[model samples]
Every structure is written in structure tokens, then in C-alpha cells.
Target chain A: DVKVTQSSRYLVKRTGEKVFLECVQDMDHENMFWYRQDPGLGLRLIYFSYDVKMKEKGDIPEGYSVSREKKERFSLILESASTNQTSMYLCASSFASGSTDTQYFGPGTRLTVL
Target chain B: AQTVTQSQPEMSVQEAETVTLSCTYDTSENNYYLFWYKQPPSRQMILVIRQEAYKQQNATENRFSVNFQKAAKSFSLKISDSQLGDTAMYFCAFMKHYITGTASKLTFGTGTRLQVTL
Candidate 1:
């Protein structure tokens, strides 16, 4: 079974503070993603990494960035946390394209910005 | 951009009953994958079932199944013999094929909240 784990299940930060959310996968999948889930808005992608040091902006990438220094780890960084950034963040991992593979998600981290 | 829509916001069914969750998507691509994901109170996303757009037959996983209407671009999930454990926020997603060594991104629906009562 593919297991994806997030670093923190809950986090609180003040406005303008930088925050980091970490995600790791045991399956060595090549693709990792970060998404912020909101009611009525659905899960919107923030960022995604296809390989080490390679990253792409998803639909909603403002005020957020990602890091993939290694194959097993992906990190999401909030450049300047704001109250609007408070939402449930989810991490997911999957095999590279052409496999008809599904993304395996981690237990989400509910971040609160004060 | 591909879009997924779950028109129903909430649904309820009694134990041993069946319920269906509706999903619709709009995309220009002909080849892709559709999925139903369940996120319980634990907030862990679990894959319930999947259907390929090219396949004419519907996909099923035990008590979970999908009615895939290709031409209409509608995919709905059906859960049979609902249990307490079946209560969750169910999301429908779509994935387009990416290039070699690249990642395929999934666009998810707004989610339907399912409640199973006695």
C-alpha cells in the first residue's frame, strides 16, 4: 500500500509569518502535489513537483511555493501567511504519467492563520 | 482547464439502502480518467472507484460502482447497503494524461456530503 504522510496535522501561524508543510511518501512516487481544500471551492492545486528540483505552478500558486530536494519528500511553503491562507492542506503522491495511476493522499493538515 | 462538478451538496440514506452521488465534468480531451474519492471524518482521501473515458463499461469495486455516461460527460457513484462507515465527503476527480516522466494533475469536484442513518 502507498502511504503518504504530512509533517503536521494542525498548525497555527501569525500573519506575515512563513510556514512550511512537509509531505513524504514511502512508495518513491515521482509526482507529489500540494492542495488547499475549501468549502464550495473544492480542492485547488497549489503546486506540484515531478522530479527533484523541478516544480510547476498549479491553478492557484499565489503566495505559495514548493520544494522537492529529494524523491521522497515534498514541502509546501507559505511565503507570507495571511488569514486567507487558513485552510485544510492536503498532500498527495503518484507515479509519473502514462500509468493510469491514481494519486494517494495523506491525512490533511488543517492550518490556521491568526 | 478541465472542470468537475458535483451538483449535490448533501445526501442521506438509511442503513441497508442505496444512494447515488452525481458528478459531471467538462473537458476537450478525449482520453482521461475519472475517480470517486471518499474522505471520512479522519480526512484521509480513499479511492472508491475509477472509470476510464474510453471504456464503455462502468467500473465497480465491491459495493461501490460508477455509472459513466461518456457522451453526456457524466459520472455518478452508487453505494449499496450503506453503512455508518460509509458516511463521508465524496469527491469526483478527473486526470488528464501528461507527458513522459511528468505528473498528471487531478481536478476534483466540490464534494458531496453523505450521511447514513439508522
Candidate 2:
């Protein structure tokens, strides 16, 4: 079985504060992704990393960035946390060999910005 | 760009019954992948089932099965003898097939919330 774990399950931050959400996978997958899930809007990709030090902007990349210094770890960074950034954040990983591979997800982190 | 649509926002069904969730996608790509993901109250998303556009046969996993229509671009999930554990938010996703080593993104629908009642 594949295991994807996040650093925090819930977080609270003040406006303009810096926030970091960490994700780690044990399956040694080459692709990692960060997504923001909102009601009625579903899950929207924020950023993804294909390999170490290689990152790509997804559909909604503004106000967020990501880091993939190692194969097992992927971090999502908020430059300046705002109230609008409060939402459930999910991390996923999958094998890079085929697009048909299933992406395993971690229990999401619900961030609250005050 | 690909878009997945799940018109049903909320659905309810009795335990030990059957329920079907509808999903439709709009994409020009002939070869792609479709998936149904279940997000329970625990907030952990799990893959329920998947269907490849190239395969005419529908995909099934235990009590979970999918109805895939290529030309109609419709993919629906049917759960037989639904249990309380089946209550969750179901999301339909679309991904374009790429060559090996190419990272592909999944376009997800605004999930349908299912509540299994007694």
C-alpha cells in the first residue's frame, strides 16, 4: 500500500504570515502535486513537481509556491497568507511512467487564515 | 483543456441499496483516462475506479463499477449494495494520456456528496 502523509492536519495563521504545508510519500513516486479544494469548485491544482528542483505552475498558482528538494518530500509555501487562502489543501503523488497510474492522496490539511 | 462535470450536488440512498453517480467530461483528446475518487469525512481521498477511453469494456472494482461511453463522453459510477461507509464526496476526474515519463494533470469535477442512510 502507498502512504502519503502531510505535516499538519489543521493549521491557523494570521494575515500576512508565512505558512508551509509539507507532504511526504513512501512509494517513491516521481510526481507530486498540491491542490486546493473548495466547496462547489472541487479541487484545483496549485503546483506540481515532476522531479527534484523541477516545478510547474498549475491552473491556480498565484499566491502559492512549492518545493521539491527530495523525492519523498514536497512542500507548499504561501508567501503571505491571506484570508482568501484559507481552505483544505491536499497533496498527491503518482508514478511518472504512465498517466494512467493512480495518484495516491494524503489526508488534507485544513488551513484557517485569520 | 478538459472539463469534468458532476451535475448532482447531493444524493441520498438507503443502505444495502444501489446508487449511481453521473459524470461527464468535455475533451478533444481521443485517448485519455477517467477516474472516480471518494473523499470520506476523514478527508482522505481514495481512488474508487478508473476507465480508459481506449477500452470499450467498463471498469469494475468489487461492488464499484463504471459505465464509460466514449462518443458520449460520459462516465458514471454505480455502487451496488451501498453501505454506510460508502457515504462520501465523489469526484470525477479527466486526464490526458501522455507518453512515458510525462507528468499529466487531472481535471476534477465539483464533487457530488453522497449520504447513505438507513
Candidate 3:
């Protein structure tokens, strides 16, 4: 089974505080993604890394950045958490190709910016 | 860019009954893939079913199935014998066919909140 784990299930941060959401995937997939889920807004892509040290911005990349120093680990950073940034964050990984290339998601991190 | 839309914001079904969730998308690409993903409460989101645009047959897994209509740009998910465990948020997603260099990122809908009642 593919397992994707996040660093935190829930996090609370005050405005202007820097926060990090870590994600680790057991499967050796080449692609990893970050997304935020908001009520009525659905899941919007934040950023994705195709390979270690290579990242691409998604639809909503503002106020967020990502790091992929290692293949198994991907980290999402909030330079300065704002109240509007409060939402559930999801991480996913997938093989670059093949029939089973569909992305597998983590349980998610619910971040609250106070 | 591709976009997905889930018209139903909320849906309720009685136990053992069947329910279908609607999804529509806009894409210019000829070859792509459509997926139905289930996110149960705090649980990890998972793929329920998938349909390839090139294939005419609908995809199914156990009680979960998809009705894919290429001409209409619609892909709907039907859940049979609905159980309490089936209650969750269902998202419709679209992905362009895999290219060697480009990332096959999924574009998701706003999602349908499904509730299974007795």
C-alpha cells in the first residue's frame, strides 16, 4: 500500500508566524504535490515537485513556497501565516508514468492562522 | 488550462440506496483522464474510479463506478449499496495525458459533500 504521512494533523499559528508542513511518502514516486482545500473552493493546487530540487508553481502559489531536498520528503512553507491562509492542506505523490500513476494523498494538515 | 466542476454541493442517500454525483469539465486536450476521489472526514483522499478519454467503457470498482461521456465532457460517479462509511466529500478531477517532462497534475472540482443516512 502507498503511504503518505504529514508532519501535523492540526496546527495553530498567529499572524506573521512562519509555518512548515512536512510530507513524506513511502513510495518512491517521482512527483509530489501540495494543495489547499477551502469550503466551497475545493482543492486548489499550490505547488508540485517533479524531482528533487525541481519544483513548479501551481494555480495558487502566492503566499506559499515548497522544498524538496530529498525524494521522500516534501515541505510546504508559509513565509508569514495570515488569517486568509487558514485551510486544510493536502500532500500527494505519484509515479511519473504507468497505469498506477494516480496520485495518492495524505490525511491532510488543517492549519489555522489566528 | 483544464477545469472541473461539481454541481452538487451536498447530497444525501439512505442506506443501501444508490446515488450519483455529477461532474463536468472543460478541456481542449483530446486525450486525458478523469477521476473520482473520495475524502472521508479526516481520512486520506483516495481514488474511487477513473476513466480514460480514449476508452468508451465506463470504469468501476466494486460498488463504485463512473459514467463517462466524452462528447458532453461529463464524468459522473455512482455509488451502490451506500453505507455509512461511504459518507464523505467526493471530488472530480481531470489530468492531461502524461508527457515526459510536464507534471501530470490533477485539476479538482469544488466537490460534492455526500451524507449517508439510515
Cα displacement (angstroms), candidate 3, residue A79, comes to 0.8
TM-score of 2: 0.98
Query: How close is every model to the real structure, measured as TM-score?
Result: 0.98, 0.98, 0.98
For A1-114, candidate 1 gives per-residue lDDT tens digits of 899999999999999999999999999898999999999888999999999999999999999989999999999999899999999999999888565578999999999999
Question: Which digits, one per residue and each the tens of the lDDT, describe model 3 over residues A1-114?
Answer: 999999999999999999999999999989999999999999999999999999999999999999999999999999999999999999999999845579999999999999
Instruction: Summarize candidate 3's per-residue lDDT along B1-118 as a digit string, tens digits.
Output: 8989999999999999999999999999998999999999878899888888999989989999988999999999999999999999999999988888757999999999999999
Per-residue alpha-carbon lDDT of candidate 2 for residues A1-114, written as tens digits (9 for 90 to 100): 999999999999999999999999999898999999999999999999888988999999999999999999999999999999999999999988664468999999999999
For candidate 1, lDDT tens digit of each residue in B1-118? 8999999999999999999999999999999999999999877998898888888999999999999998899999999999999999999999986667668899999999999999
By summed lDDT, the worst window of 10 consecutive residues in model 2 chain A runs over A94-103
Question: Would you list the clashing residue pairs of candidate 1?
Answer: none
Please state the interface RMSD for every predicted structure, separated by commas: 1.6, 1.7, 1.2
